[model samples]
Target: MEEIYAKFVSQKISKTRWRPVPSGSLQPAETFATGSWDNEENRVLLWSTGDLGNLDSDGGFEGDHQLLCGIRHHGDVMDLQFFDQERIVAASSTGCVTVFLHHPNNQTLSVSQQWTTAHFHTGPGSPSCSTAPCTGVVCNSPEIVTVGEDGRINLFRVDHKEAVRTIGLVTECHSTVWIDIPTSSTL
Candidate 1:
């Protein structure tokens, strides 16, 4: 037989206070243009690409060359794809997907459109992650294909937010993408 002893100890420690972004930034392009995971001020940061831009650390929309905005998604962004070099498609772990357009001239990132009703699942029975119903998405021109852990494949068309058809399930769908290949004759 073995005996075990348990004890508890308490200690106090001091942590240093740090800040984000230097006191003053000059270069406009140095700003960020993607989603963020910081102190909740902004889920996204859009930097400038031109001359001195006016931006409020509190999110003030000022110039046309300001950082592009991100979609106000309900979940963490897992994958982001830009379509036609103008629209941004973001996939989240919560099975929610969104599309955003570039408002370059607006001087602020704005949501041109979104498709929150589209729920890509990772499992069966209501698109939950535990089931892995729909886990990933891929786009090829006019089409977007989604894969899930539920052994199912769902297809949709661009500009049209509704699912065109549901291809039978294909398990363990982590991600997908389209590759352009020439036909044998063309090759």
Candidate 2:
């Protein structure tokens, strides 16, 4: 039987993602990233489970839940998807999308580029009394796509700092998963 275990974290968890082990790399898929929300010190953390069974003499789950990195972010992380081993796209409640680059050697992650207010509560980059949450995000290499609660779909390119195109008035979208199947827009 598989044994189930749990770890107590300090904040509300919003998203968790597995760090992809690149092809032919002599590494195991045991490290992952966790994004937290609604805390004064909201942060994204990297964790590892490879040392679960490799405990120290004290038997306290030594080095198993070790924190690789904890970086502060602007708002509640709603979604995150890794394009590769080193890059990730994250959507937030602030209606923003960010591109992060992870440095495995130093166990650090940094925001490389950001599209601020990709979807507004009112409209594209528009001001409102409150901000709408970005519902989801997906990245296929150079192309990063995001959906938001304001009924907007934003398309971004890696080389570009802003979204190149947007589809709006989507009637309060909660999520969007990009599939390679052929299709056309209904709007």
Candidate 3:
């Protein structure tokens, strides 16, 4: 991480605009989807750091293009993970999972695809189908595994007609994965 100061100089106002400005310093891990892990708060602080230099002095960040399509939840993001580097998933405390796909025009950026309720608490012992927040998510091949606060694991199928193809209870186990591999036999 680099420690630098940001200062603005005005042409008309000389001494008035020439005050010492502190840009502070940013930590190494505070980049991209990575957020701050404050030991004092115990809970992680998530932030979407927009590009600074890209913004004009007129206070307008929008130029000829916008990368983010939409923001689903304004609340604190519980966790984040990437899938195949083409999509970004942000799980919120409201039991909603926001999936962002790579912008079709620009493969380098992302745009929100959808925000749906994750059924982390919608099964056998669940009270009113009110879901719990997703603590973590893992993707491997055609399957996505999401672990929630209610001690349940939801399995999702990627290339299927239905998005969430299965729902089951998990006990005394960590997680599961589905892999695809082809084999060839020659004579």
Top lDDT hit: 2
lDDT of each: 0.46, 0.77, 0.44
Which window of ten consecutive residues has the lowest lDDT sum in model 1? 11-20
The lDDT, on a scale of 0 to 1, for candidate 3 is: 0.44
What lDDT tens digits, residue by residue, belong to model 3 across residues 43-99? 211223344445576765523122233232333455555554445555555555555
Model 1 misplaced stretches (Cα beyond 4 Å): 1-33, 36-68, 120-134, 172-187
Find the 10 residues in a row with the least total lDDT in model 2. Answer: 178-187
Best of the two (1, 3) by lDDT: 1
Model 1 C-alpha lDDT per residue in residues 75-180, reported as the tens digit of each score = 5554555444455555554555555566667644456445454544443465343423234566666776665444556677766757788766444454443333
What is residue 6's positional error in candidate 3, in angstroms?
Answer: 13
Give one clash count per candidate, in the order shown: 19, 0, 0
Cα lDDT tens digits, model 2, 55-112, are 5888776666777776787899888777777777788888888878888888898988
Return the TM-score for candidate 1, rounded to 2 decimals: 0.51
Model 2: residue 134 alpha-carbon error in angstroms: 0.6
Candidate 3, position 84, lDDT: 46
Residue 160 in candidate 2 has what lDDT? 93
Best by TM-score: 2
